[model samples]
Each structure stands twice: as C-alpha cells, then as structure tokens.
Target: MTIFASYSIKGGVGKTALAVNLAYALREDGHRTLLIDLDPQCAAAYYFRIKPAAKFKFKEGPKLAGRLRRNIRESDYPGLDVLPSNMAYRNFDIMLDRLKKSRKQLRSILAPLAEEYDSVVLDCPPNLTLLSENIFRVADHLLVPVIPTPLSERTLEQLYQFFKEKKLPPNRIRPFFSMAQKSNRLHREFMAQLRLDYPVFLDTVIPHSVHIERMGQRRRPALDYAPGLAATQAYRKLCLEILKG
Candidate 1:
C-alpha cells in the first residue's frame, strides 16, 4: 500500500476535510483504503459517526487498548477502514518526547500493514511536532493544502525552507491551492504568483464555498455527500492526480 498524508502547518486550511473525502473517493474507485486519523482531536471519528464509550476507550486499560489495536490491525471494511484517534493522543508528544524511537513509532506500527491496502490516508495535525515528524518519515507522498492568502503562503514557504535547511528530501513535496476565490482580486493575484513562482503546483484548486465548510457539519466529504459540487469535483480530480503520481 502507498501511504499518503494530508497535512498542513496551519489549522483551518481544509487539510482534514480533504483527507477524509479524498480517502472516500479513492475507495469509490476500488482502492482499499485505511483512513488514519492522526489528529488528537478525533474529529475524523466524529465525522465518521463513531462514538467512543468506556468499554472501547482507546486510552483506558491495557486489555482494551491491546484488543482495539488488534481490531484495528485485523479490520476489514467493504472498501476502507479507519484507525481512529483519541483525545489522549494530544499527549503523544509529551509522552514520547524522551523516547529515542518516537519518530519511528508510526512507521513501525504501519510497516506490516503496508501491503494490506491500496492506500492509507493520514489526516494529520496542524503542527510539526514529533507526530508530524514521524508522519513525514513514513509518508510516501504528502499533500499540502495551501490557502490562497499571504499567511498561508508564508507557512508553506516556512515548511519548504525548513526541509531545505535540514536537508530533507523534497521529491514528495507536492502543493495544491485551497480555499481559492477566482472572483477575488487577491486570490487571483496569488494564483498568478503561484503559477509564476511555482510552476509545478497542481492545476486543480479547491474553491471557497459553504458547500466545503458544510462538510465538517455533515461529517462526510463532499465527494461522498455532494459529489456534484464544484469543490467535490476539484478534490476528485486532485485524487486522480495523486493516483497518477
């Protein structure tokens, strides 16, 4: 299986939304997908309508955690499965800070399952913490969602510069525009800059709309719920691009 992470350094950039829907879209195309909600908030589980109870709490006791981990490992969905997140995952950084192999934890957990599915989509947190670092280490591909704004662009530049200075590989760094508004002059200007400065940026761009924001409320991706919408079509095309890559 190919592991792809939907990530952003800034929150509210539509990263998780894209991750959730894109995984569904890939499944619709017949790829077995595992959507890994790596965000500590567990919003991905909420989106999938999974309720956590004391009996199955992922953080409670050793027996329950081990059982759930086995379940996650052996899970079989029709076309997809979810390795859901828990709120206690917020403590992952603090818990693993002194551990030498923290960055490899994610990779170790996933290596055996690498061939079990066609794709594993990780919905990542908004920070470059240890979790994000491990994500970087394991991901075969990274989809970075960049809002068409100065602040967002600055964050993207910072990310690129970070890896460049640290001498990390840049081959998998692909960027696509998000929350774009073609009617706005600023948005248009940024697109112009993106096309000029970043010639390889994906041509497919996600537009700003209530339809996209309503995704979180509906707890489903537009591709699943409103595939006729422009944003859904854009994300579908983005998924196609990812597959082609």
Candidate 2:
C-alpha cells in the first residue's frame, strides 16, 4: 500500500482538508482508502461525521494493531474508512520515545494494513516534533500544502533542509500551492517563482474558496456537497496528479 501523509510544519494551510478530500478522491477512483486522523484536533474525523475513538493502552504489535483495527469506522462513502483521533493522540510522541526504533515504529504499526487498504492517507499534526520525524520516515509521499507567501516559502525551505540534515529522502516531499488566489499578483508571482525553483511542486493548485472554508459547517468533503465546483474539481485534479506520481 502507498502511504500518503498530508502534512506541513505550518498549520492552517489546508493540510487536513487536503487529506480528507484526497482520501475521498482515492476512494472514488476505486481504491480502498483508510484516512487516519493523527491530529489531536480530529478535524478529519469530524469532517466525516465520525466521533473520536476511545483511546487504549499500547501493548505488543498484535494488540496495537487490533486496537487500531477496532477504531476504524466505515464512512458514508464506499471503499473509505476513518481511524478517528482522540485526545490521547497528544501522547504519541511520548509513546514513540519508549520504542527501540522510535523513528520507524509508525511504519511497523501501519504495515499490517497493506493487505486491507490500497492507500492510507494521514492527516498529520503540524509540528516538527519526534512524531513528525517518525512520519517522515514512514510516509511514502508527504503531500505538503504551501500557501503562496514568503513565510510559507521559508518553511518549505526549512523542511527541505531538515530532510538533507537528517538524511531523509527529500524527493518524497511533493508540495503544491494551496489557497491560491489567482487574482492576487503576489500569489501568482510567488507561485511562479516557487515552481521554477522547485520543479517537484505539483502542477495542480487548490484555489481559495468559500466552499472549502465551509467544510466545518458542511462536515463533509467538497466533492460530496459541492461537486462540479471549481474547488472540488481542483481536488480531483490534485488526486489525479498524486495517482500519476
């Protein structure tokens, strides 16, 4: 299975929204997808109308996998499932610290799911913590949402530098413009500059839209409620780019 993580060192860049919508898109393409809400906020799960899962004590590998399995909830969309996050997820870094191969433990935990899922999309918390390192080690692709701005550019540079310093595979980082405003000259210029500098940036851009902002109120992916809209079409295009990758 391919593991795709929607992550960014900076929050409010549409990471969770990308994860939720991308997972739905993957399901629509006939892939059995599992969306795991790793953020303590559990916004991805909330989007799916799923409640926070009960937290459990971590044990051996089998037990841990069992716990994760029990927490998986079928979504309204066929071929898609959600493993909702809970407050206990805040302790994930601490729990990983206790493992022998802490930076790689998440990979082992997720390995068993390959037989059941064609794709696993993670809605990761925004931070450069130990847990973030673990995610970097495990995820096959890091889908980063970079807002077109100076600060966002610097943060993306920092992430690339971190990868170089830590000897992680930098090529795994696939960034794309999120909340892009074509009407804004700065946004357009910054996007052009970034694309020139970083050829790995996906061609698809997600536009800033009221429909996307209303996801909290709608409690579902834009494709579900606002299909045929530009924002929803952009998500589909992004998903196609990922699949092509």
Candidate 3:
C-alpha cells in the first residue's frame, strides 16, 4: 500500500483539508483508503463526522496495529474508513521515545495494514519531534501544503533542512500551494518563486475558497459537498498528480 502523509512544520496551511480530500479522492478512484488522523486536534476525523472513543492505550508493533484496526470507523463513503485521533496522541513523542528503533517503529506498526488498504493517508500533527521523525521514516510520500507566504516558505525550507540533516530522502517531499489567493500579488509572486526554487512542487494549486472553509459546517470533504467547484477540482488534479508520480 502507498502511504501518503499530509504534513508541514507550520500548521493552518490546509494540511488537514488536503488529507481529508485526498483520502476521499483516492476512495473515489477505486482504492480502499484509510485516513489516519495523527493530529490530536482530530480535525480530519471530525470532518468525516467520526468520533474517537473515550480512551486509547498505546502499544507496540502488532498490538498497536490491532488497536488501530479496532478503532477504524467506516465513513459515509463506500471505500473510505477513518481511524480517528485520540487526545492521548498528544503524548505520541513520549510514547515513541520509550521504544527501541524508535524512528522506524511507526513503519513496523503500519506495515501490517497493507493487507487491508490500498492507500493510507495520514493527517499528521505539525511539529518536529520524535513522532515527526517516525512519520518521516514511515510515509512513502510527504505531501506538504505550503501557503504562498514568507513564514510558510521558511518552514518548508526548515523541513528540507531537517531531511538533509537526518539523511532522509528529500525526494519524498511533494509540496503544493495551498489557500492561494490569485488576485493577491504577493501570493502570485511567492508561488512563482517557490515553484522555481523547488522543482518538485506539484502543478495544482488549491485556491483560497469559501467552499473549503465550509468543510467544518458541512462535515465532509469539499469534493463531496462541492464537487464542481474550482477548489474541489484542484484537489482532484492534485490527487491525480501525486498518483501519476
């Protein structure tokens, strides 16, 4: 199975939205998709109208996989399932820190899931901790949502530098413009400059739109609630670009 992680060192750059919509798009493309919310905020799970259970106990390897399987909830969409996040996940770094081969432990825990899912989309928490290291080691592709702004650009550079220092393969990072305002000159300039700087930036740009903001109210993916909208179409194109790669 292909593991896709929606991640960024900076938050509020449309990362959760990317994960939620990409998972739905993958499901629509005939893949059995599992959206795993690693963020303690649980926004992706909430978007799908799924609630986490009262408690979740952390474990290692097989036990961890079994716990996740038990927690999986079927979404309203046919081929999509969600593993909602727990508040306990806020301590994920501490949990991984106690494990042997900690950086590789997440891959081991998620390995068994390949039998059940064609694609696994992770809604990752924004940070650079031990858990983030584990995610870096586990995910096949790191889909970073970069807003066309100075802070976002700085964070993206920081992410790349982290990968370089850790000797991780930087090729796994696929960044794209998120919440872009076409009429804003700064947005256009940064988008062009970033694309030139980072050749791996995906061609699709998810424009700033009211439809994406309405996801919280609608409690579903924009692809589901506003399929014909430009932002929705951009997500579909982004999904196709990632798949094609």
Candidate 4:
C-alpha cells in the first residue's frame, strides 16, 4: 500500500483541503482509499459528512484515539473508510506521554491496514509532536501543502531541521502547492525557486478559488461535488502526479 500523509508545519495554508480533495480523487479512480482524521479539530470527518456517534468518543480517559483498533473494515466508513476523531483529541499528547511508550503509536495502529487498502492518506495536525512523529515513521510519502509565500517556504526549512535534529531521514518528504495564486508574481517566483531547489516537490498545483473555499462549507470535496470544475480537474491531475512518484 502507498501510505501518503498530507501535512504542513504551518497552519492556515490549505493542507486539509488538498488532502480531502486528493483522497476523493483517488477514490474516484477506483482505488480503495483509507482516510484517517488525525486532527483534533475533526474537520476531515465533517467534510465527508460523517457524523460522530457516541461510540466515536473517547472510551478511555484523557485520550481521543479511535476505538476501532482492528484493521479498518470496509464498513467502518460507508463510502470510504474513516477513523473519525472527537473534540477531546486535544488531550492525546498527555495521554501518550503517560503511556511512556515509543511515540510511534500512530504507526502501530495503522500497520494492520497496510494489507487492506491501496492508499492510506493520513490528515495530520499541523505541527510536529508525538502524533506527527508516528505518522512520519509510517508514511511512505509525505505530502506537504505549501502556499506561495516566504514564511511558508521557510517552514519547509524548519521541517528539515526538525528531522535533522531527531536524526530522521528527509528523502520521504514530497511537497506541492495548495491555494496557489498564479496571477501573483511572488507565487511564480516561489514556485520556480522551490522546484529548482527541491527536486522532491510535485508539479501539479492546486490553484486558489472561491469554489475551493466554499467546498468545505458544503461538506464535500470539490472533486466529488463538482468534478467538471477547473479546481477539480487540477486536483485530479495532482492525484496522477502523486501516483507517478
């Protein structure tokens, strides 16, 4: 299975949107996609219209981990398998610390599904922590959503440093642009700079649009709700680029 994680060290740069749309695009291609919602905000679930039942809540104290510990069955998510999260997930750090185990809990949890699904797309919270570490440990390809800006570009530097300090390999990371404004000169400049400098960055760019923003409010991926739209087509191309690698 190709385990692709969509994450960004910096928030508010459209990471979740790109992840959601790309997962939808993969599902449309007849691939059995497994999307794990790792963010404490639980936004991915909302986007998929998956309601949180009482069983989805934290059965144990101080942890927001999913209760479905088995290999994610097809029925876990009616359309596509989703390991949903709850608001209490913000407490997972302390809970993980209390266990005093390797921070690779997320990897061990997802290991069983490696045999079941074709692609495992994890929507991680935007930052480095125990959860991020475990996600990286298990990820085959890391999908970073970078905007066209200096600060966003700088976050890429910090991500490399974080791994360097921790003695982790950096080759698995793959970056792409989300909400790109092609009309802007700076966007063009950053794209050229990063593409020349970072060979791992993908080619397909997800352009900025009102349709993409409103997609979240409508509670569905733009590709699913409007596949004929320009944004959807761009996302599909991005999926092809991902599969190419």
Report every candidate's CA lDDT: 0.76, 0.92, 0.91, 0.75
- For model 1 the local lDDT of residue 42 reads 72
Residue 9 Cα positional deviation in candidate 4, in Å, after optimal superposition: 1.3
Q: Over the stretch 118-144, how does candidate 3's per-residue lDDT look in tens digits?
A: 999999998999989988988989999
For 1-245, candidate 4 gives per-residue lDDT tens digits of 77889888888877778778877878778778888777878777778776542345443333323364431334223446766666656666656666645577666667667676787788888888776887778888888988978887789988888889888889888888888898999899988998887878887888998888887688888876687888779989988987887
lDDT of 2 by residue, 20-83 (tens): 9999999999999999999999999999999999868754454766786789999999899999
- Least accurate stretch of 10 residues (summed lDDT) in model 1? 53-62
**In what order do the candidates fall by lDDT, top score first?**
2, 3, 1, 4
Top lDDT hit: 2
Q: Model 1, 189: alpha-carbon shift in Å?
A: 0.5
- Runs with alpha carbons beyond 4 Å of true place in candidate 2: 58-62
lDDT of 3: 0.91
lDDT for predicted candidate 1 compared with the true structure: 0.76
TM-score, one value per model: 0.88, 0.97, 0.97, 0.88
Off by over 4 Å in 1: 52-68, 71-77
Per-residue error (Å), model 4, residue 58: 4.5
Q: Give the per-residue lDDT digits (tens) of candidate 1, residues 152-239.
A: 7688788788778756777777788988988899988988887777676888898888887887788766777788988778988998
